[model samples]
Target: MASTAITTLSGGLVSVQASLQSRSKTLGLNLSCSKSVSAIRGLKVASNVQIDSSFLGKASNSSLWASVVSKPEEKQVFSSQLQPQASFKVAVLGAAGGIGQPLGLLIKMSPLVSALHLYDIANVKGVAADLSHCNTPSQVLDFTGPSELANCLKGADVVVIPAGVPRKPGMTRDDLFNINAGIVKTLVEAVADNCPDAFIHIISNPVNSTIPIAAELLKQKGVYNPKKLFGVTTLDVVRANTFIAQKKELKLIDVDVPVIGGHAGITILPLLSKTRPMVTFSNEEVKELTVRIQNAGTEVVEAKAGAGSATLSMAYAAARFVESSLRALDGDRDVYECSFVQSELTELPFFASRVKLGQKGIEAFVSADLEGLSEYESKALEALKPELKASIEKGVAFVHKTAATAAST
Candidate 1:
């Protein structure tokens, strides 16, 4: 027989109790509800619920609840264990843009986020208002225009910049540089001035160029921390993993391919020889997969016939990276992801590789992944260096030219 009771407590609180009697053993649960009965439609169980020891004693022999009942003195309640103690404030720049809107929605659903700030040049308030109705834990705030940018970034723990023009049919990422470069430079300057210590994820394209532009801008502001600045090449990695999974018929969750170098055409290198679970590939298979991965962005753009770029997948990848970063910030011990950052892994000043993330930022780079490359991968790696180097130098030059022009004026 089972019995349940509901009692109203002081201060608009409600108490729910349930007891079950089976085989002469009684199991009881006491839940302290924070909401009133009227608000119980989507009520979450309070963390301070009490559990009778008889239930633990009866379930001690069951392997399913062993971990829950093993530690009685530690007071490891299930609800409390699931609650995140350390939540962070994340700010999304260009929240009204194609990538920013979906990215903001995904991030708003994270249990680890306490505040979500959405900033854009226009139409951001409506976006924020829409996302606020999601019934998530994070409070959504909107900041419109340059004047409100600093407030959006203030006290933010992570700043994600996806605020730039999208790629159209027949437009190379470099074609976006002139417009997106200035956008990234302006947004990054606001980041440097407001949340200098925050982890900055640059998702603006030509990431190969915009990352360098961001680094230079931060350097000028005297707040550049190589570890905290990242060029989000997660999209490339996501595309690689997904493509490889489809080719091999492996589960998508079981596949992981490390993408390196820059974020543009040939600069995007998918290390097929280094895929996890150690699958063998024919030379033709390797070539086909590598080229497809590198050109995945163009495939999406062309598929849409200039409608838009890879906004949904880009948002997904960015959200995954953001979650990994938040986990690292929340003291998760073994958090690692592929990101483009200031690195000594290769001759290039900045490269994308697997790096271990931590409380402050990048704790260590998995530089060993670069060793013992396949012959084809080695040749391709060498082939990408010059073009990537040229892009890097171009970005550096843009910043310097801009500075010099301002000084001459």
Candidate 2:
């Protein structure tokens, strides 16, 4: 039987609290499990560890109970009931930003994250302080500015970067390239120095450029793991699903669209031909839907005016991808999602398609046959490469230029 969490404590529930070892593991204490809790693994507590009876107050609220003892270290399962509780460390760069704030909340709600590290240039400490109050199993920590960046990424299993400016009205993704490019470069460099093998999810704008920038930086550090780097195009897929559901008048959850290629204007390709439940569309409908999916980001930018971009929806989409990644880390071999990564699906070095996720990250890139593509998809795929190629080159050039500048200085 799969490990299961204890969810059915009726009336006033009592938290079975026990002290656990600290981060240093210097102190040793023991606690015996009840006969009913025979599946409890290695029940040890330090002498300094103490149970806070306050946890009993939260019986009505649905939050995982964590030992308040010790700085957040590796997870220790107190019993088999907490089986699916997440024990991995996830660090989010730009955790104080628009998308990061909500994204942090979603991850906090997960039973999978044991520790959550929030890092940003500013405003992050407060965000961490705010999120810490939520009674989740995951412990939250904040690191502000570049000085603390390495500390934030130190032991992360997954590092998510949403650290960049948002798109403005009338601005193409390339328009934000120069600014976001430098940001991604700097952040990925820190990631390289610290958690080189962490599953990297790049959500910076101009992802076509930033993802390549990340790939190259990791290569420069000699720690490039192709299976680990990902450009989150989940928003494109999310939009495709929503729009397709509306167009076909079907239930939203029933819709599934695989968005591929680089994550930008023309490059965002929704494989409408491969939508699940086998939906049908006319040529005209397909054309219109395709265009809408491609331009969905702009729609949000325009709608938000100048205040901000699609923070909430982008947060939702990003959270979806992060959850899938955490699941993959937890040894769920069946977890698969569409993302941009180093690939050979086309002449380009990177492409987005459905990829099977597991302990080793991307186990396989599963793209549908392009030879059997519909006429529109083939044309769209051909036309997208030029802009995408330019973006990729720009990213590669930025890294080389930065390295040269450093060498010169």
TM-score of model 2 vs. true structure:
0.80
List per-candidate RMSD values in Å. Answer: 10.0, 10.1
**Model 2, 379: alpha-carbon shift in Å?**
1.0
Residues 1-409 of candidate 2: C-alpha lDDT, one tens digit per residue: 2123323232222233222211111011223222222222222333323333332222211112333321123223322233243478999999999999999997876666889999999999899999999855689999999999999999999999999988665677567888898899899999999999899999998888888899989999999999999999888888888899899997654567788887878899888888865889999999999989888876777787778788888887887787777767765555668888998988898888888888878998775535577888989999998888888888889889999999999
Supply the TM-score for candidate 1.
0.81
Worst 10 residues of 2 by lDDT: 19-28
How many residue-pair clashes does candidate 1 contain?
A: 0
In model 2, the runs with Cα more than 4 Å from the true position are 1-86, 169-175, 369-371
Q: What TM-scores do the predictions have?
A: 0.81, 0.80
Candidate 1 lDDT tens digits, 289-328: 9999998887988898878889999998888788778767
Give Cα-based local distance difference scores for all models. 0.77, 0.75
Among the numbered candidates, top lDDT falls to 1
